[model samples]
Target: MVLSKVGKKINDYATLVMFSHTIFSLSFAVISMMLASKGSPSIHTIFWIIVAFMGARTGANAINRVIDAEIDEKNPRTFMRQLPQRMLKKKEVIVFTAVCFLVMVIAAAMLNPLCVMLSPIALFLMIIYSYTKRFTWTCHLVLGITSAAAPVGAWIAVTGEISWVALFMGAANTLWVSGFDIIYGAQDYEFDTINGIHSIPARFGIKNALCFAALFHVVTVILLVFVGILSGELGVIYYIGLGIISILFIMEHRIVSPDNLTNVKIASYGINQIISITFLIFGFVAVIVK
Candidate 1:
């Protein structure tokens, strides 16, 4: 009975890990390759790069959940998580984390020397982001930066060096993620405040925090536009996609208000998913047309 329960718990945790959608990280990598190669990257390169990204993202998220299990237990919104609910053991999480890290290292080694060398640093940032909430409200920004590393790392994987375009993408991702994160944090305002945790919503109240979130997203659009211009790879399809994304962004903000969080789920996951998919499609079209 004990072994069966343990197996079930592991399966549940694994499902959550999969649902975390580290594919978003992989999407950034795909975009980077498209930009760098001006069309398509070799299948071999794409395969190894994706493996590295997935391994790293899974490792990072699992470690984050493990480390924050105590905090999650305290927060109503997160109390149901596997670790917080004691459905999974700490030892199991630790072993899974180590395995994920090993997979990342192996994948990085197969990619290039630069990728291998920087893998540890990238993992460090991902790991550090999990704890930033304990210290500052800037934790959202830290998480943004960590996620932004997807494009930057992917760029390096392709060109094996840093590029201004990659930095631009990183900046866009930074703001995009920070903006949505602010929205997500709104759901935790009461919990955050009661727990003495710092967050934009906890520090500034929802209205002002949401305004800041809008500002960040505006910056995200601007940065992406700037990157497109600099690359000279964008076309009509890209602009159309941008228009849709902008509309979606506006709609995202419109749906959520300080007085009500009814639309929070729609804006955070639903609309954001659309925006990412739009960008990915546009990016692919831009490279193909050029």
Candidate 2:
């Protein structure tokens, strides 16, 4: 029974990490390679970068879950989380977080000196984002910027310097993430308000929050366009992919209304996944084809 309980706890922990979007974070590393290489980065470099991204993301998320245990226990949608439900002990999470952070640091060390130096900053921002909701509705933006760090970090890992193109990609991702996060927060509007937590939905209400989300998405697209233009690296394929992204964004919004949130999952997971994968593929193709 003890072994079985441990296995269940491990599964629960895995579920939490998966939901934290570690895969999405790794995808940014892939996109960064696409942007950095004139053609393609070495397979070894890609491997290490992916490992670092995943480890860092996992560490950040585990810390967030541990810190938010109290909040999760009070929120209906989150009360069943591993930590809140007592499926995983606090000590277990602390050890896991340490392991994840160690792995990230080691992976970053293997990548490059720049990546190694920046790893702490990236981890710091990731960890900070979870607490931002306690004080400000701008938490979503902080989370967005945290996610954006993946591509920027990857770019610096490869080039060992900052570039305007990389900054543009980061900005574009920031807006994209912020927009979707606002939509996702809609589900917790009431809970957030009651708990004195700040979020766009809690502060502005659903309808206006959705409007802000749309506006953010528009800014995302504009930034992406500028990135393509400034890099001069993308071709017709990239534009086509961008068009598809636009359509997906539109469909995502159409499915979710202020009064009806039945399509929340579709908008959040379905369309966002499509957008990320599209960016990865097209971004890679543009570099390779050029």
Give lDDT tens digits, candidate 2, residues 1-290.
99999887777878877654555555656766677875677787787877877777888888989888999999999998888878788888888989988998898888789888888888888788989999999998998898888889888878888899889888887888899989989999899999899999999999999999999998888888887888777788888888988998999899999999988877877789878888778877877786
> In candidate 2, what residue range of length 10 has the lowest lDDT sum?
19-28
Worst 10 residues of 1 by lDDT: 18-27
The TM-scores, one per candidate, come to: 0.94, 0.94
Q: Which regions of candidate 2 deviate over 4 angstroms?
A: 1-10
lDDT of 1 by residue, 1-290 (tens): 99999888767877657555654555566787788767778887788878877888888888999888899999888889888877778888889888988998898888789988988888888789878888799988998888887888888877888899899999888888889889999999999998888899999999999999999999988998888888787787877888899999999999999999988878877888888888898878878987
Inter-residue clash pairs, candidate 1: none
Report residue 188 deviation for candidate 1 (angstroms).
0.9
Cα error, candidate 2, residue 170 (Å): 0.7
